[model samples]
Target: MPSKTSIFLTGATGAVLTRLLNHPSSNTFDITVLVRNADKANILRTKFGIKTVVGTHQELDKVESLAEGAHVVINLAEADNVPFMKAILSGLRKRQAKLGDPPLLIHTSGTGLLADDARGEYITDVIYDDLNVEQYKSIPDTAVHRNVDLLVINADIEGYARTYIIPPSTIYGIAKHALVDAGVSNPHSIQIPVIIEASLARKHAGVVGKGKSFWPDVHIDDIADLYVVLYDTIVANPENVGHGWEGLFFGENGEHSWYQISKAIGEAMVTLGICTGPEPTPFTKEETEKYFGSEQWGWYSSILPREPGACLGMEADVHH
Candidate 1:
């Protein structure tokens, strides 16, 4: 049977969750979002027309009652939201003992779970593929994620819910409600100011230090599509994996040098009408470092290598 209103999305109103809720397909499913307040959740329900369950994560034993007979539970639950999730999973299992079937639980995890740089490289396709998600769950650098991901993965074996983990890279998307200050500006939103200034001045946006420390990034639209892909897989088979997604993961300039990055930024500013004609002036490595406030600042210049021209158009086998 179609999950319909039986779907429960923890962190229903989270940033990524917020974007998912706004999609046109949201109405096609009878989604039940779990939040902490009836009033605020009610606003979401009124605005988005999804049911809301009010309770804290630690109070998730109460969630199963709210989720009775649910088919799928997509958790965008917070990183620290595990206490609530544990309670919910345990509670759901107990409820299922008397009720029959448990719901499918789609869990979220950080891709940073793969913390070991096998090649001492920031990130790369070979490095990414060499790391197993299951193995990644055990890496020491990702101790917290290991425990959380393990809990979700073992949910069914422990006799609660069927589970799936979505380990995401640096997620960049439009914000829903300025939930929290995200420290650094989203790279996609505004052109890097240094790049803009240098590009306009027609100079290189040089790397600040030894450019290293690769960061994985995906557009908000592509990230959202990853979920859509998951839903499609679920339609064909419930036991689908997200990291298995195939194709280009990064867009144009996924991997760029300080000079190259600056050039691209200058190019973008022109496209955005932020800068006219000339490329920006170059900054000395030290100057760049000073502007960025650390030798680490130069790391942004070193992007992971691009797969191929056409390949850049594809996304990673994120569903694996």
Candidate 2:
């Protein structure tokens, strides 16, 4: 019988990772998760039969210790948490040095790194493809989500770990994971949920500027499938696995404009009697920040133009 792969996971409570943990194939792995609260972790532990370590990103030592023993370390936490990443990499490095076998590190990033400050008023033709080496390298360091991704890629290049970066576009749709089977409904994604909240608060659905900005979108289930495929591919042929920045992956099914999104929200609100009309309202940048807060202002307001040619490549590979 084949031995079970030991997988160490962080951000197990998150939407994408939650779906991953509940995947039927995940049962083949001996999984351990690092969660902030033991009580909160119990649900997944019971439903998925995975072990848990109680800790947060702030507890670097504990995180490193947990990561050191795994064949795969999957990080779905904050993309910009450099200190936490460094700690995980350090632990993986120590293990690699001792065993002479590098473990796979699957890290989450987002297409938001390629976002432009359009404030939903305009669209650009500049699109990035992961398969295009020159275009991928052309991404500036100043990009919103670039720093942490660079750190992980550089670590892989330095032989600390075999790292893969999954940069998903805006994710939508309800999640169906082990927790759901155990009677827990996963929270909605940030964009639509915040828009709904703002609409309810202000008595109308609103969009930033002209709301012309566009972003790629994918279903939560599709995103989960990508994770499973990538994990299996890496474990099966670590020798042929892509290295460093070359391991970047993206997931996008289709693209939508913010105007269309807001219009749908407005129409829904009107149908539900939450609003008087279906006409979408426009909010200035200041108004957007006021409603969604400064931290998420860009997420709801900025234009993130991404091409899914690379994602399509992966989809074809997985399906065929």
Query: Which predicted model would earn the best lDDT?
Result: 2
TM-score of each: 0.59, 0.87
Question: Which whole-number lDDT from 0 to 100 does residue 52 have in model 1?
Answer: 73
Displacement of residue 75 (Cα, Å) in model 2 is 0.9
- Give the poorly placed runs of model 2, Cα more than 4 Å off: 14-28, 183-187, 295-320
lDDT per residue for candidate 1 within 229-249, as digits (tens), equals: 665576567554333221112
Clashing pairs in 2: none
Which candidate wins on TM-score?
2
lDDT of 2 by residue, 175-231 (tens): 755566565335555556666677677888787667777777778778767877888
lDDT of each: 0.48, 0.70
Q: Whole-model lDDT, candidate 2?
A: 0.70
Off by over 4 Å in 1: 2-5, 14-28, 36-39, 67-69, 117-126, 130-138, 141-144, 175-209, 239-320
Angstrom error of the Cα, residue 214, model 2: value is: 0.4
Q: What CA RMSD would you report for each candidate? A: 8.3, 5.1
